[model samples]
Target chain A: MSAALLSAEALRIGYRGTSMLPELSFAVAPGTVISIVGHNGSGKSTLLKTILGLTPKLGGEIRIRRDARLGYVPQRETMDPIYPVTVGELVETGRYGIRGVGRRLTPPDRARVREMLEATGTARLERRLFRTLSGGEQQRALLARALCAEPSVLVLDEPTASMDEKGAHEAMGLTLALARKHGAAIVMVNHFIDLVAEVSDQVIHLDRDHQRVTIGPPAEVLKGRGSQGRYSS
Target chain B: MSEKLALFAASWELWRGAVAAGVVAGAVCGFVGIYVVLHRIVFVSAAMSQVSSLGVMLAFWLVQAQAIETAHHSEDILPLLFAALFTGVFSAAMAGHASARLSDRTKSSEAFIGSVYLLSSAALVLVGDQVTRGAHDVANILFGNTVIVDLPHLLLFAGVSLPIAVLHVWLRKDLLFVSFDPVMATTLGYPVTWLRVLLLVSLGMVISIGTRTIGALPVFSFSVLPPIAALALFENLRSSFWASAVIGALSAFLGYVTSFLLGLPTGASMAATAGVFLLVAKGLQRLRD
Candidate 1:
């Protein structure tokens, strides 16, 4: 019965002594996609990091209902290929909340992992080493990992930054499907305006220099900003 | 002929304890090595081992000096355990601090580890001056001591290594996620700090327990070589763990057996054997390409 799936009231985020954005507020509703666009180092990633609890919120409060769970995909560059984890095991981590601590993954959890992997079109790579996968494959594997959590909210930071045009389109399609099919609130920070405009219902812009949050429809927010439209240099 | 047989027999009796140490050492090294290779912190493993040796040597010197006046029973063992524990805990803390303080500027894991190793080496030699005659044995301990493993030490090694193996298995997924992308793992709510601490502490325990039997130098070899071998051969986390464990145990067994026959140092021999496998595995990989 809440209007917001997740809400940040006057949130402040950044490293100590060098905060990027000013006091910010935003609300994400169920089954909606919000694309956060900003220039590099504009606290876009910082905002996502703070919201997902990767970093501390410098001020204000972040509130999530006890029943809510989150699945997150970090920037493509953030993941290194040295580790020898399989896609299946990576996805299985999403089900950590389903079972009790110290307990092994149940059959249901395993099935869910398989289901998510298949749904994300990464079934054949389930046994493949995560390090050996291509960039798009890695993104799909991460998506499978996120979906396995059965989360109420999905947060992705530049999920398709390194993908080909086709891969980017597929990623957007899958992301939109994830939100629509699961009724999950999707908060994604991306640089591609045209791709986001195709899938996202709303857009939020973090103006690092001006220190403000600009939220509106994708066309309206991106209209006057041209070339530098939100993510332009 | 009988003299040769008697020497062989004497060594075989020593083999009982050495063999157990070999198994424990292999398992611990292989398990901890995964993290070292993944995180590029192999030097931390080496430094921790040296620091541990320094602690043991210091404790031995204190006990020996005290025993000159009055024979110390619990006093020797207690100080040794205390020294190892202190070094393990402190080294981990120092490494953590260095890593955090220099995250964006530069990684300080190596610098911190080197400083700690140097400090420990100085402390060890300075304190070990008390036992002039036993310096040879102490030196061997720094390298390793397959010729003189006792039952209690073997049991201690097993007790420590087994729990670490189990912990690694239980936390397999989270460890994989953290190793792959700590940023994302943290966002997904994995306790990255505590996980790293757990890994470091387990590695410390392994290093401390195997200090005498596997020797500090070769103990780290097990940690580094086996994981690399596993990485080359396997793709999955569980597969890597199993493969590393198997290869580690095999190398230990082969090392001890070959040393028994050829009169080589077991620790060095085991490390050499593991290294050879790594070469062959890498060579095979090159051939495929």
Candidate 2:
């Protein structure tokens, strides 16, 4: 069996020195999808942020495979829409880690950006201002930005929040396809149980009532004896 | 009109210094203003300008207390140097305040910025009163007397601003990334905190030198309005940058000419011209929308 791309052992997540969720332990292997589902303020997004190292972990350890790259799709609401960046320019920022500082994008970088845009169905909106795009379009553009980096670990925060049913389906499908193609470990914070069960191999439910995390395969976690009943579609 | 034109031409040598100062101030502010606007730190810039002006006034007070015959030594740049130093100190403080985990504080960063602006303004007035001998200099510091800008002053402004501008252009992408999304920039291994501090330091240096050369109001206006106008007019960051510089340079030249022709204050005229550009650009944006 392949080694886990990302593993968190008894990880505690929070903000400003306060813990928000119970300790979580999980391991994500390549080409596998892990969904973090919880109620509002259940620290679902905080877990993702902790994994990306945006927020400091309150306790425990997170280990990523050596030389593993991380791609992040932050919540759309967190980004200010007033910035004057085009879809193409926004996506190109994903190359910053790959290209390093003070280096201009090469032709291959541009080609990859274009390919990602096309794959995410945002090629037509490449020249459009990021602020001007609709919610669905913006999500897809953000996904393209994340995918363009070719990360070994892709972490998305509510990738389909505020998206229509069809848009969410398409976005999830595209995400899964990219994960399979790259054999990347995919971790996402999702609220929709049906969508979570459809795409994720494992579901880590942050049961706010019990203040504990339950992690297992989707079938067992969603329908088995440990099922919380709050995740019904 | 011909007489006015001939008058401008006749004293072209004297006007040259003022024109150079205006152009440099406008260009530098235009370039740095993009970060100011994108990072949403206009209030910080405003407060810093006030603090810088207060520094100049304090320098004058100190020089006067020691009975230094500043009138005989009009060539002295000690005050400007002191102003820059004070501005740097204040900028460091502000940066520290911003970076502090202020979850326990009731007042936000805006409140701190507002308090700084008010306190600095009051301190400038108090210092200006104590240093009555430097009253003319105080007036010059408050509202710029750009017509009296000499070659040495213009050179001093250029010496500080030019290299900062080049460095900003060289690191424009990193700067923009850090400004636009600091968290993501950090995730990508960029030094977000250091970059933010660097940006504030550069802003402080510009305001320090600019307030001494062109006065506080004009420096603040130049550092704010042009980027706003450019952002309104252009959809792309590169276009916005270029357009902002052009607009700043043009506004400076035209405002100087207008001030000279109308017998108005040069700095206020320049600031007013920038405001007009902002309004026009905002109108154009509305029409497009």
Candidate 3:
């Protein structure tokens, strides 16, 4: 692999000083997808937020490439529907990262937004209010927004949490294909263990109740958990 | 009605400055208040109004204490300078408020806004008792007097608000992005802190300058009510802002005219007019629904 897009060493995740998950380390490179799966309150979110700089790290060192352009797709619920934003407008906001604030999007930026919207199968829904979209469509539009910036690293929180089973599979497949196409490193928290196991290059399973951190390719990391892993998902 | 119109037109020279001040106050606060409404910080604007009132009262207290001697010494800008400094601190506070979850906000963020409103309101009342030698009466000091607003004061009000309105419009996208999603905005390296500072500074200017002409009550009402009416009426953000500005200006104009015709107090008249707009907006929204 080329240089890693993001790496963490002996990193612990928690609030203040209390550690919820034990020390774990992993590195992700461009064009690769890393999926994190854990039960609710298992520190999956804390760890993701820790790496993404939303929350502070409890211990250890994490480094993202200095020049990397970061993109984020929070769960649809994370966005306030009261904002009165259209899908196209929401997608266009992705360009704000690349162009910097106070600068309007240019023609090339608009083209990229359209391309991403089309790629995510959200072109037809561009004019619709983002809040009015179905769960699956909202996720796809948010995906388009995340990709619109051509980010070097993308972080997602429960991108398909609101979708149906089939939609979940499609969303993950689209995510993998899109990340590969854009050569972006993907870090996502997903509830679908099978989906994560199917598409991810690396998997991080955080069992906070056990104070355990398991990191490896899906087969190697997931093979031993059997019923517990299945039950958790 | 024609007779009233004729009478009002005849008195336009005396009321023109106050009317112009009302329109500027309405438009600027209406624009800034959209964020205040959307961010669920109506109380922040209310509290900032009290903070600005206290600052102005402090200016009056300074005059009474012989801190600065001039013609109309209460017009001194020590309050504005003080307000600007306090608002910069609130920029950080609001940034913290923006980043916290809604569940955590009541304890962590809103409590601060509540504290400021209470403390500032109390201090302003205590200080209002000491200004024995100014042209401003205690009633006019707290509620403000657009009816008596002079040319220089109107110019000053416009001077402060217009530039802030232009900046808000110019950075509309960036400001919206930061307001809607501080996490992603910060991740993307947008200047979240500076944007918050700009927003707070704008709110401060609206409250401080506005209280000088229109008083705290109408300033708060203008900042909140027209935006409420606008948000209820428009589904588009830009439309909401435009409607808000227009409604605010109209309300101010109508309120000024109504005060003259009905012999009502100017501040109360403007606030009541905004209340009437809010009711009409609610009715239209229900009908549309």
Candidate 4:
């Protein structure tokens, strides 16, 4: 496989010193997609937080290429709408990650912000208040914000959890095209098993009750573990 | 109106330092208040102000007990140092454990803040009673209606506030990002913890000096009211920062002038002026809706 952008070896994840799942090993190469699929009680969020360095790792090691930058797309509902930010301004903040503090975002940065919004099909809504957008639009805007950072690895948390069927598929398609176009690795946490099977290059299936983590191709995982009711809702 | 203006101008030499102090302190508090209001930690401001008041009382008590005679009211700044130290420690605690985190919300945590407020309020009175010059002096400084501003305090207020204002500007986006989306800020490699500590430390300094200069009522008002007034009218947060600063400076200056004219208390007058602006802003917001 190509040089991995992110890899975890015998990674133990949980709160404090306790392990939530069996030790796992995986590597995500550039220009590929890996999905962490689990139900509500599973430790997918803990795992994601550990990877993002928001939470401390319990044991083992997670490595990333030295030059890699991680772009995060948070869930739409997680962002409070009370802030008076335009969609354009919301996307503009993504450049803050790239530009750091104090330094202004150059013209190229502004152009890139506009470009990402256009790519996500939210360009026309740039002037509108971000809070006024529907849930699906907010999700797309978040995606645009993540891409605006031009990260080497893009982490999306429940990217399609709030979208309708059509919007969800459209978002997945965009994710694939953009991943290939930018050569960025995609690590997504998703509850929808069917969608994960279709879009992911590798799937990590999590079972909370049994403290199980199954990692394999989507077809083998789905057939062996049976498709979860993620989309049945 | 002209007569009042003329009276104020005649006393300009006496009042110039105070008016300057008001404007500088008002601008800093107003600007930082944006984060204070947005992050919903106005309680932190209130608690810090009370704690600083306690510090002021402690300074006056110590001077009286030791019979320390200071030149040109050097005793006044003794209170300032005491206040800064007290409030600095309080703000550090707030920033480290809860206030700066912004997202940390729990009843027990709020209870801790509320306890600080009550204890400081009670302690200021107790400490004041021990000052031989009369608690009235300490009370006057802590919550009085009028201000007799002098050169040294004015210079001190400006010296501290001006740098903080510049720091806020230089670090505006970083502060805004943390206040708005701290988790994302953390993921993007920004020093979220240090930024938060810096924010609260800056806030503590402003509140301590502003309380020493204009009294707690106006300081608290300046730190909260203007940002709220700005938020009600502006659809953009950055625009609100500018508006809040303008409103804060205006309210402070107007309150000082009007207090001198109408024989009212300066701190309350300033607070009332800001309150009036808040009412107008809310009215305008309703109309817009």
Q: Is candidate 1 or candidate 3 better by lDDT?
A: 3
Model 2's alpha-carbon lDDT is: 0.82
Q: Give one digit per residue, the lDDT tens place, for model 2 in A1-233.
A: 33888899989887667777788899988778999887776767678777887667999999988867788888787677778888998899988878877789999999999999998889999899898888888888888888888888888888888775676788888888887887678899876667887888999988766787889988877774333223322
Question: What are the per-model C-alpha RMSD values against the true structure?
Answer: 3.1, 3.0, 2.5, 2.5
B1-289 per-residue lDDT for model 4 (tens digits): 7898898999799888878888877788999999999877889999999999888888887787776666655877788999999998988787677533333233255777899999998998788778777755665666645477778778888999999999998898888788788878888888887888899989999899888887888889999999999999898988999999999999989988888889888878888888999999999999999
The pairs that clash in candidate 4 are B145-B265, B145-B266
Better of 1 and 4 by lDDT: 4
What TM-scores do the predictions have? 0.90, 0.92, 0.94, 0.93
Q: Indicate whether candidate 2 or candidate 4 has the larger TM-score.
A: 4
Candidate 1 error regions (>4 Å): A164-166, A227-233, B1-11, B64-71, B91-107, B129-133
Candidate 4 local lDDT, A1-233, one digit each (tens): 33888999999988658788888889988888899987775888788888998777888899988888899998887786767888998898889978987889999999999899999899999999999998888888998898888889999988888676677888888877876787789999986777888888898877868978888888987775566447322
Which candidate's DockQ is highest?
3
lDDT of 1 at B114: 81
Residue B12, model 3: Cα distance from true site in angstroms? 1.4
Which window of 10 residues has the lowest lDDT sum in candidate 2 chain B?
B98-107
Residue A87 in candidate 1 has what lDDT?
Answer: 75
- Candidate DockQ scores, in order: 0.47, 0.47, 0.63, 0.60
lDDT of 2 by residue, B64-157 (tens): 7875556655525777777788888877877666555222234377877888889999999998999866677777778776576788888989
* Model 1 chain A worst lDDT run, 10 consecutive residues: A224-233
